[model samples]
Target: RRAAAAQGTSLYEEEEILLALIGGKDYNDDSKCKKKLEEYCQGLENASLKKKEIHEKLKDLCEVGKADTKCQALKTKVTKKCTDFKTQKLEQAVKNPSDDNCKENERQCLFLEG
Candidate 1:
């Protein structure tokens, strides 16, 4: 759907701008970065849970023929976006290679694997 595609494109563009802004800053404190990453991961997890809940509700509606195909499509889009964000953060952690960043990256890997 053109609307979903447009939304994805806008989301990607917005994330790019946000990353650009963040990359411009000099993070001398690894603790701060680690804290931020933790918060971000938590937020991502919460968002994923909320999306799942919404999908289930929509699925119930669909079963009654009250919902359309857009619900699943939106879930897919959101999952992809979250994945893209995680990948980008992992790449940044690899580039920095701080102790905290490494731990965070490992934690993320385990989280993803599990």
Candidate 2:
């Protein structure tokens, strides 16, 4: 998306596949699964925004020749948040594929393997 690009971030290919899957779903008012998926995905998006903010701050600090330890700490936080979000999403997709609109794109749910 344009927003992600503006933030100097990019979605992974797997996320694109996931998006295609979600796009195919019927998002009616009665679809509790869709609602839940939306909420979960929203959380992921917020996490991504936070990561981007951290990156921007780190860039600013680097430009000013700040402490390496501060940058390292921020990088660690970003890495942990990214890892946790990915793991949670993959597990959700595998455990509730339909809820994630992944039923039709099951093959793309690599997390389901092993």
Candidate 3:
């Protein structure tokens, strides 16, 4: 209908517009099928718009090593932080439970110091 309005022809009369509006196996050019195509296009447009909007919302404007002060989502914030360090620490801590040097250093130089 929109294509027909835009170019003054039915969807079939405007071959390119019809094809452009239609996609893969989910919809065809029959009566009910065309209705389905229009509905799918609306849904696709809405989802695309939402994805673009979410990309904008999740965007971080920080330099290297700087946390996004305003980004409060734990999952997203963790993506920006160093998880490699946590994995490395777990590997080391598991491999040698009695590594006093690492433990003592962390005790004095890490949270204990702060």
Q: Which structure among the candidates has the greatest lDDT?
A: 1
lDDT of 3 by residue, 10-88 (tens): 3344222223233222222234434444454465567665444422322221223212232223223333222543565
The predictions' CA RMSDs to the true structure, in order, are 16.6, 17.9, 24.7
Model 2 root-mean-square deviation: 17.9
Q: What TM-score would you give candidate 2 relative to the actual structure?
A: 0.30
Output the TM-score of candidate 3: 0.22
Q: Which clashing pairs does model 1 show?
A: none
- How many clashes in candidate 2? 0
Q: How well does each candidate superpose onto the true structure, as a TM-score?
A: 0.27, 0.30, 0.22
lDDT of 2 by residue, 1-114 (tens): 544455454433333233323322322222442443455446556776444554332223322323333333433444454466558665666676564355333332342231
Error of 2 at 112 (Å): 17
For candidate 3, the lDDT comes to 0.36
Clashes of 3: 0
Whichever of 1 and 2 has more TM-score, that candidate is 2
Query: lDDT per prediction?
Result: 0.41, 0.40, 0.36
Encode model 1's per-residue lDDT on 1-84: one tens digit a residue. 244354443222433223222222212233443344344435546766454553232223223322223332433444564487
Which pairs clash in model 3?
A: none
Better of 1 and 2 by lDDT: 1
